[model samples]
Structure formats: C-alpha cells, structure tokens
Target: MKLNTIAALMALAGICSVGVAAELAEDPEAIRLRIGTGDPVAGKAKSESELCQGCHGEEGVSNVVGVPNLAAQFAPYLIKQLSDFRTQSRRHRIMNAMAEGLSETDLPDIAAYFASRSRPKEDGAGGPDANAKDLFLYGDVERNLDACASCHESDARGRVSRGVAYPALAGQQSGYLRVQLLNWKAGIRNNSPQGVMNRVASQLTEAEISELANYLSGL
Candidate 1:
C-alpha cells in the first residue's frame, strides 16, 4: 500500500511538471480550442436577465457555500464546467437545473461575463498551518504525495496551460474546497486532469482535507 501510494505521487509529480516554468504563457492552440470569441456584453445582459446574480453575485463572487466564485476564472474553464453540468457529467442539483435549460449559444456569453469580472478582494486572513504549508510546498515524499504547488503554484492561483484543469484555490470558500476534496477522495468527482485529484486526494485523511481547505481559503 505504501509503495503504491509513492508510485502514484511520483507519477503525478511528473505530470504536474509539464511546462511548469511556462504554464502561464498563452498557447495559441489552447485559446482557439478552449474559447472561441465570446461577447462579454451579451453575456452580461444574459446573466442579468437569467437571475444569475442571485447566487453568483453581480460581480461573480458567490457568497453561498459550495457555490464557487467565478470572477477572473479562465473563461474556457467556466464554459467547460457549465457544459458539464448541462450534460450531467458534473452534477450539482442547482447547477444542473440552471445549466440544462441554457441554449448552446448562451454558454459562451455567460462564461465571458463572469470571466470579465474582477475577483473580490481577499481578506488577507493569514497563512497556512505548518502541516498544511508543508503539504502545499513539499508533499509528503514518504507517502508518495506530490506537492500542491507542482500545479497550483505557491500562491495557489492554478495553472491554465496544456489542458490542465487546476482551479485557483486562493481565497476560495473553505467549505467548497473541503467538499470538493472529499468528493475527489470518495470518487464522487472525477473531472480533474488525468484524474490527478482522485489519486492525490485518496491519500489524504479527512483532517488533512480540512487543514488544507482552511489554509487555501486564506490565500
């Protein structure tokens, strides 16, 4: 069991290192493949009329637990998520209901509007616990765990290149992070890149999940 865990961590560390130094540099192919030209103006209008602001704030910062803040998220990521909810590939009772009825044309606009919004200012809460910080900066090699910074970066802002599906963790709701981590652990969520989260999270205890969530929320 220990060997298997180490092997998984070693494999993931390799996967996450692809273009680590250049992860933020835009790839033209990625742009074309992920997001076509979207009309932010139309998206704004559509979002307002659709009552999207009720849950996701007018500016895209969501106050609701388990609801993610969409502001400043990569447009294509948001588009993919909405489409996934529509197709039931990623299920959320509320999101499925909201997404299922949207027309194919409605997706791009809505994603664009949220992407155009700036993220809400962070509270500057503080730092991570020692254990959490170690996990984030340097994974437990004995357990074969890869560092979170391998993909999400030290600031927890995430990587967007090479079809990587990492999400920005900084200032994200702690409850949301905790639930998602639990989902990954339990196999309830399976949408991440190369199923990396599934493997990485399976190694974490529930207490570690909570500790990581609390640390990331303050970033």
Candidate 2:
C-alpha cells in the first residue's frame, strides 16, 4: 500500500510538470486551431439562436441539478470542451448534438458570451463534510494527491489568461463532476490538461470522489 501511494504521488508530480509544460508550449497558432478569437457580441447572438438559454439559463446559470452553470467559466476552457464534444473526445449525448450543430466560428463567440457573465449566486446543496473539505483544500500527500485548490483556486473559480485555462468548479453541478471523475479514472476521458485529472482521479477512491464532488458542487 505504501509503495502504491508513493508511485501515485510520483505520477501526479510528473503529470503536473507535463501540464505546466503544455501550458507554456501552447502557441497562438495552436490556440487558433483549438478556439478562435471570441467576440462577446457574436456569442450572445449565437447563444440565443442556438437555444442555449433553454437549459443553461439566459445568463449561463443552470437551475437543473446536473447541468453545469457556465457563467464566468473561462472562455478557452469552454471552447476546448465544445471542441472535445464536437470531435467526440468527450461524449455526452446532449452536448454532442449541441456541439455538432455549432460552426467552428460559433465556438469562440458562445464561449465568450458565457465567460463574460457572472456566476449565478447559489449556495452548495448540502451540509459540508470536513473530510471532503480537507481533501479539496489540502490533498493527501501520503497518497500523492494535490489539493484541488492548487490549480482550481481557493474559490474554485478557475483561471484563464495568457493562453492558459482551467475549468471553474464553483457552483458547478456535482453530478457532472462525479461523472467526469469516473470517466477520467476509467480512461474514458483523457483531454484534461496534460492528463493531470486522469492521474488525480486514479488516486482517488470512489468514496473520496463522491465526497469531493459533493463538496465542490456547493462551493
């Protein structure tokens, strides 16, 4: 067990290093290929026309239990996710259909519109768990897991600037987080920054994943 823990930690460290390198190595051309320059105006028009309002809400907040709130999400992150859905790198029946209908030019604009909005004011759904809180704020070094806040920010708002993007977890759907974590652990999702999430999820037990997801959804 100790050896497994050590190996997991080492693996996580390597993933972090690779992720940072990938961030730094990303170039303008790469960015253009992944997500073109976003125009908020164009995005708003597309959002309305695309019927994003029906589910994501008029301002990008989702009242549905499992639908993520997109307001204030990083534009680059949003674009990347949309791209993933389009290419089937990530798979969700609803999201795949929505992404397939989106033109390449529409990706950036829609992302921009959502990114321009503020996250809707909503409290987390349940009472806090000290164990989960501790894990999210301070990962178990013994197991080689990094704190969620190390990359996600203490508030879980995520970060995006200078060609780097991290997805915001604050006020996001717990169910969605749970599903994605499971996918990462199962190797069904490999599109995370430098496969860091794959490594992170692999180190987490099923109960730990549940605790983390529940804690994050209410943030």
Cα lDDT, model 1, residue 94: 86
Which lDDT tens digits does candidate 2 get at residues 88-182? Answer: 99888999999999998898888866765655445646347899888888999999899988888788767665666877887777787888889
Give candidate 1 misplaced runs (Cα > 4 Å): 1-36, 121-126
Local distance difference test, each candidate: 0.71, 0.73
> Considering every candidate listed, which one attains the maximal TM-score?
1
TM-score computed on alpha carbons, candidate 2: 0.77
Clash counts per candidate, in order, are 0, 2
Q: List the residue pairs that clash in candidate 2.
A: 43-109, 124-218
Instruction: Tell me, by lDDT, which candidate is best.
Output: 2
